[model samples]
Target: MSRTGRFGENLAINGIDGSYGWPVIGHTFDYLSDTYAFGRTMRARYGDVYRCSAFLQNFIVFNSPDGAEFVLKDEASQFSSKLGWEAFLGRLFPHSLPTMDFSEHRHHRRIMQSVFKKQALVGYVPLIDQVVIGNLRTWPTHQAMPAYPAIKALTLDIAAKAFLGLELKQDTHFINQNFIKLNNGLAAIIPWPLPGTALHQALKARSNIFNYFSPLIPQKRRSEGQDIFSRLCQAQDENGADFSDQAILFHLSNVLAAAHDTSTTSLTITLDLLCQHPEWQQRLREQCLRIDPQDITYDNLESLEEIEWVFREALRLFPPAPQLFRRSIKECQFGNHIIPANTQVMVDCGYIHRSEHYWNEPTKFDPERFSPARNEHKAHPYNWFPFGGGSHTCIGLRFAIMTAKIALYHLLRDYSVFATEQARYRILPITKPRNGLPVILTKN
Candidate 1:
């Protein structure tokens, strides 16, 4: 069938307006090719509430903060995160928190929350600092290096040590390799496990991860270790029910991926921005110098005001998870449109984060916009939701922040970084440097 015929039969029947692009493939190519441009073009042409098909499914894109708030908060209990993420991550990461819904999601999140509480987070600081400081020291000073891959490797090591309690180099190396394969599969347009496909490799990686952690779970549950893995093994809900073996495996896989991927992206972008604006780098470095590295702790991390602003601005500019997905469980009204049950909903957070209507000089790398004097993000509750909002917000919100601050503190305190002019980025999957963010670290 033609594009209009397909759209009319599927989308228009529900009273939503937008193009389905092609018949079967829809706008998959357009979306995967340039997610931001496609989103911006759609908003410009069809406004906030519009329907489009991609990855063999129909999605109603919401580009406004209010729309984001509605789906994220789910005050009416009208959406299912499980159904929403199932298509993308189900095969690769089954039973993970992001793929869970409503009550089940809450139950699992509550038990998992113990591992990220303030006391647990405080213990993680030294683990993070050790990995970061050691890695930064090994980085060749005064020589240009690809910062993205380097930081990606560093964050993976940190995740291994801090989250999984894996310190052996060979063990961390194995986890890093497989996790990369698993992450790469998330962007697969075809989610099949056919030979040599991204999904096939990811499936294999998932099995490998399961095998690696299966034997360790029993041992971890019996111990009182400090790493997240041990804590998770020992964590119990109100009913004193600990996670089953399968649950532990799933949670560990999900948390390790989340811990590293997001920090790597945020840190890469923040470093690139600082490289492009040395004035801010020097200013942030000066602030870091004042605080003795030994004085930096989870409780005092917020005291490094300049570093926090810079990282927050980087997240605002390029949120690692730019689009938050949800599926309507029942017919619901979102703004002026009626959304039918079982419809996939995407909050265009990337667009909202940089919308001219919501921010002054939205595209500029101005960290001061986040300062208390300015507090531009305070204009709207949903405006700066990089970690998401409401009940479904990232459980690791503070952990990710703490990890970023500790890494930044160690690096900036010892070295000044300079980017090779004009570093560009690609936004799909997650925002990352197109050229790996090449930069040189110069000892101060």
Candidate 2:
């Protein structure tokens, strides 16, 4: 309630403990080099709630479930998702759901909710299976395959058909290339669209995407197709509000990116984990073998309980989006600290996901932790929120789960995946294998 002290000045006096590191650059290099190590070191030094500087900004890192609740729930409306995501995604995905706050976010979310509902999701299973099965068939067996890029391309193909309603023959290569550019821009240090910069190329890609989708909006609106694009075109809220032409483009761009990237990361990690743990992989494969390959539907997808647990463990170990960002709109109390307004707040879900305080053998890749008998994740609501929590929780979470389940079921059923060697990961920005997670897929 008291806005008595500025963020940096008199931090000790204000009871918030943290260091600003070096001037201007702050701890950007340290943080970027290895976010997991940096987070662990910080938490060890300062407990759960601490302040540190990164990427030229000071952030109060909340590395606990309670901190996750306070910032993510934002019960007092004291935080802004729009302001939080602006630094990362504003240039590429302006006015998208992630960049909207409070009532505006709710309004937009309501209109788009129908497209991701149970019925719609059920309709997508066959399409997803088609893409997954078709792509998996093309993967070379008995050799080391780069899983990340291969899966990334497959996810883009899935998105093209299921989300954009595009035919397989369409120019998905252009879409894939542009999306890669846009993703590269998220890590740009400059953040400006200056000539020859990653941001500049990303902005150009954004324009190209807009131009590609803009003319098609009118046709989609009039059509009766069931793909996400058509459903979004016909989406309307209780108040009869609909997405404008530009809103549709923005939502599609953001949704497409989130859909593919997160799913790709999740599938790749699950595959990697399964490869590393042959016992779990065999168990999951046995479960998958029980289901008739022709009958892989939304109804039967839930039967693969071990597969679900494996996916949960994979997300727990390496969340797709490690650190979630939020900016304070007003001074708020997080535990004992009085965080100043306009301060950037990061909920280190990645750190908390692996914290010793929460789980037994936290770093161990044991899927049984999520089994009903153990259920360690149930100890706290926020302990396992990979798709995030609260109002801004990913709308496509169910879709992501379904896609992963289907992809894993088919891949594991046909081929036995083996890790050639231990794979290293790049944690920040997004969790991905540094070496693309090379593995051999031997056909059964």
lDDT of 1 by residue, 1-444 (tens): 212222122233246889888987889898778777787899999997898888777788898888889999889999888877776788877798898887898999999999999999999988888899889878998888999989988998888788878775777668877887888788777767789988888889988999988999889988777899999899999999999899999999988887788899999989988888889888988888888887767877878888999999999988988888888877889767988876788898888988888899998988999898999998888889999887889999999888888998888888989887667777766567788888898888
TM-scores of the models, in the order given: 0.95, 0.95
Backbone clashes for every candidate come to 0, 0
- Runs with alpha carbons beyond 4 Å of true place in candidate 1: 1-14
| Model 1 accuracy (lDDT, Cα) | 0.84
TM-score of 1: 0.95
lDDT of 2 by residue, 198-283 (tens): 88998999898899889999899998788999999999999898999999999999898888888888898999888888988788
What is the lDDT for 354 in model 2? 90
- In model 2, the runs with Cα more than 4 Å from the true position are 1-15, 168-170
lDDT of each: 0.84, 0.86
Q: How many collisions between residues are there in candidate 2?
A: 0
What lDDT, from 0 to 1, does candidate 2 have? 0.86
